[model samples]
Target: MLHADLDSFYASVEQRDNPRLLGRPVLVGGGVVLAASYEAKASGVRTPMNVQQALRLCPHAVVVPPRMHAYSAASKAVFEIFRDTTPEVEGISIDEAFLDVGGLWRIAGSPVEIAQRLRARVRAEVGLPISVGIARTKFLAKVASAVSKPDGLLEVPPEGELQFLHPLPVERLWGVGAVTARALHERGIRRIGELAELGEGPLAAAVGPAAGRHLYALSRAQDPRRVDTGRRRRSIGAQRALGRRVRADDEIEAYAHGLADRLGRRLRAARRVCRTVVLRMRFDDFTRATRSHTLPEPTDRDAVLLHAVRTLLTAALPLIHERGLTLIGLSLTNLDDADSMQLTLPLEARADSTLDSTLDALRDRFGSDAVTRAALLHRGTGLTVPMLPD
Candidate 1:
């Protein structure tokens, strides 16, 4: 069984502590709607919506900057409670996780009893409400959690999975986005139960074999996936929206180099190196394209990755001009664990990798802006990307 959510997560935390903000429409960011209270969501304010637009929808909404530190602290507290209750626990995200209580089924009386205790502890100790869903599979557990929101708990026994899942909207299936849902709807399959009636061949004809078959399997609640121990991130990449204007290739390459440098630092910190570097370019018109090339060897060298990215940018210059490039991104994939210690290699081996790590250490101890590539020094923007602690 996995309890897979934080009920109103960020919004609920703010409302819980700040009694003044209770019951009023609230949003959690100044620039964009990072989160919105359910009341604010009713008025069309939603996550990722522009703050200005959210304000237009709910004029009285209290918008606050994100308090990530507070959220992280709260997550730790909740996970502690979860660990206390169950031995086999897997965290999927900061606010959502899985608790495998198979061992405690007898000790805690039953899964239901354990869930009740876990929910009570969260509401009492963490001071935030959450939703819990119990099932034999991770997929059904997630579905159950979504169905039972706002401090609710739902349990779906193994034999009752299809009965509980099939009648749901097509959107309930994992990876079914709005576009996929619309495609399914066009085939007159709005409900998962309806999809069950469309045999494999006809379903494949409608949405392509891979997607249709997957959806059909999920519709039947026939998932065999287990709660994995979790896999290390194969790559780290970041991109910034360049507003709605065309930028020259040299200017964009400079920014791309900065992004690669940051990614390289993260890779080194994670002790991971990549053999493939991917470049993503997005145009002002919203069309995007990506290209990837394998390096000579797996390396976390910034110069190697940036040189590849520059070559890609040079080749992509024509398309950038044609589509009006508005965004550029860099990613390192095909990873292997890197060594913290260095050794002499072929002439093409990293010359700056060691130097980069040293500088990264300085920047970490001091501040990032304290060190900069001499070329980027002229521009003075140190580095920009969302970084999660490795």
Candidate 2:
């Protein structure tokens, strides 16, 4: 098993595209810090922190707005490279994946050689730094990647897994968070080797029973999970945060339409159709409400999904007016393969379908902004941050 993770994905992309930002402290995002370059990190800047605080930490950092489209394109290209390296690839996020290369030893050389080649390929082709960890188990592999970061590689041989793992801090074990670390510290158990000396009963008393047993087993290097690539997503969705800004009904509707358009395209691209359309809303006060409608038939057509979302949005207008919406999102659920779609449709429906296909092709060739709905002409879709992969 090999775990591959891109180092500071969003910030690295910004630096990679602009030579001026290279080797400089870079921060990405506006209201909050989504990613910070290693230079910025060295100055105490961290992701998901307040933008103002990040700047205060690294006053000289170059902050850049996120480009969702570019990130999406890069993620697709990276995943393609991963799949090419090994068929059994499990994508954990936009910039991380797990590749099982155990079966390719004879054909691809040893695991260490494969990992080196994979890292070299990513840097040469994608122009990004990636850290890879190789181990007999997935959990250990993931931990190894973190231990050797920022364009580094490390492998834990089966014969010496314990020797490599014992001296590490207890926090390296799965499920050991700040609270757990503090609890362990109080008990004078700061290392994995020390924790391994405790019995399950003592470990459970320190933490909860389940977490204690889990940690006890993991401290012994007993993770049994595998890299799975056949998992299917339960839903597809997109959302935009509205901060403290109060939005008008028309503006909110336009954003909703935009989310629908993006989600619809994703559904079509995945060759899936959904039966349920759900509308999620958040008010300025931070309270949220959800409304959903299930279609009689699954459909990936943009008009159908957008219309359903609009109906739900219309029904929630009263709440929006009372609470003042600050966020809007759309989700499609209960999906099925597009091949299951009916072979026949009414003449008008078929005509609309043809138009949808044509629009999709044009957008694919020219770009998402090549064509836009009349409603979005005045109020743009707003900034969309690229989300982690499913």
Candidate 3:
């Protein structure tokens, strides 16, 4: 198993395209820090941090707005290389993927050799630094890649997996977040070796049963999952982060409508229909909430989706008013191919279908801005972030 991950993907792309940003601290996005170069990270700048706070941490950092199209193109090019390397590539995100090269020992020399070649290819062809980790299990491979970051490579052989893993911190184990780390710290279990010696029963007592089993297994380097490429995305979604501000109900509703509109178009473009519409919100206090409504029938129509979105948003308005929202997100879930949808006879429904098809056609031929909703005319459409295929 090999896990290959691009280092500082967005920031790397920016630095690669512009020579001036090569060795400088580059921060992507305006309101929030989306990606930060290693130079910026050295100054304590982090992703999702407020840009102002990041600037305060790294005063000389160069802030750049996110270029989603460029990032998408880079992702496509890199994935092409991954597929060319191995047919068994499981993409974890736009910047990382797990590959199984077990069967290529005779043809490709060894796993370490394959990883070295993969990293070299990415740097030479894509002009970006990538880290590659080789191990017998997927979990160890992922952990190895994370440990050897920013253009580095490491291999954990089966004979020495424990020697490599046991000395690491307990936080290195998956699912050991800040809360879990504090709980384990209180128990005097700070290392993976310590946690493994604590026994599964005691670990379960410390954390919940399921998480305990998960962390305990990872502590022993016992992941058995393979790199699977057959899986498809369960949901398609989009969200916009609104800076700290008091937005009126109408403005919020407009944002919801805009999200629904974009998602509906995406669903149709992907030839998928969704059975559920979910509204996700983040309040100013950093708390998150979600409300979902499953429709009687799957749909890709903008009107149907917008209506469901508005209904969910309206129901959550009282809570939003009380908490003050900082973000709005919409997701269409329970997706199935559009060809599976049954045809209906209502004339109004047929008219709506025609309108949807016409608008999609216009947008595909000309541009997304070819048609617009009256409500969204003056209110600018929020940024369209790049996403993996649905």
Candidate 4:
């Protein structure tokens, strides 16, 4: 079964520990509302809101900075409980995870019972509240968790997956985002229940051929997505908001190449070779789009990923060519867990591994973006990476 998530995690922790902060509006992160307590939410403070604006919404709200180490320590304790319950655990993110315990019903008890114990353990040990959603499929379980948020547990029986899923809004599906929803809405398809009426052909035409069929299948709760254990992510990548909109293609290419290089470097450091490149772009309006391509061969090299990223830039560059842009991210996928680099290829990309190693050393010594290529010379500290201030 799958578990959903925690509601207002950071703020919940802060409120649980401090008696005075309990029942009062609380906002984490003085710079931005990283997490806002339910009280703060009721008062109009929201996550990602600027502190000043949030303060205006709730003058009496308690504002605090994020304590990553404290949260990390708490998360570790929570994961320990998860491990104790099941062996197959998949970390969805820092805040949530999934556990596959298909046959543990006898020892671990029923899904509902296990969820109750797990939630209780998390609250008792880590002092943070969590909501659990149990279901036959990972997707449904995640949906269930959203339904039973704020220290609650919800279970969708095997036969009820479709009943629970189909009536909800289309935005609940994994890949359905704002743009896709808008496209569906344009066709008078608003609810997941209504999607069944379109039939697959009409639905496909509405939201692109690729996404429409998949979404139609999902509307009927027909997901075959496995809880993959070998999902040893090939790369760890991050994107920074440029703060201001950027429209030029050259600037976007240079920025994307830098990010690709960073992802490739991280993949190499972990001794993993990725055969596919995934590029994720978040437009100014908070909507995200992704494109990916499989390389001819596996590589942990910077230039290979950069070439694909640049190619993707040519495709998506047109959209942002005249418009404002906000965030861009790149990641490498199809990872070969073992670095089985066969040096037998007749045509090889330039062996710039040495140069990458040198640049990485420099960046480690000084800071990231410290040793950039000539192409990146004018991209002066574009979007900043978060750093500990002196």
RMSD of each: 3.7, 3.6, 2.3, 6.4
Backbone atom clashes (below 3 Å) for every candidate: 0, 0, 0, 0
How far residue 190's Cα lies from its native spot in candidate 3, in Å, is 1.1
What do the candidate models score in CA lDDT, each in turn? 0.80, 0.88, 0.90, 0.76
| lDDT value, residue 84 of candidate 2 | 87
- List model 2 lDDT by residue over 1-390, tens digit each: 999999999888898899999999999998889899999999998878999999999999998999888787777778888998999998888899999999998999999999999988888888889999999998899999999987799999999899999899999998999999999999999999899999789999999899999999998888999998987788988888777777778878888988998888888878888999999988878888999999988898889998898899999999988988878889899988887676555523334457778888898899787888788896666665555443
lDDT of 3 by residue, 129-228 (tens): 9999999999999999999987899999999999999999998898999999999999999999999999899999999899999999999999989988
lDDT of 1: 0.80
> Model 4 segments beyond 4 Å from truth?
241-269, 273-339, 343-390
In model 2, the worst 10-residue window by lDDT is 344-353
Output the lDDT of residue 230, model 3. Answer: 85
TM-score of every prediction relative to native: 0.84, 0.84, 0.94, 0.69
lDDT of 4 at 276: 77
The model with the greater lDDT, 1 or 3, is 3
**lDDT of candidate 3?**
0.90
Candidate that beats the other on lDDT, 1 or 4, i.e. the better one: 1
Candidate 1 all-Cα RMSD: 3.7
Question: Largest lDDT belongs to which candidate?
Answer: 3
Question: Which ranges in model 1 have alpha carbons more than 4 Å from their true place?
Answer: 13-19, 76-87, 246-251, 339-353, 363-390
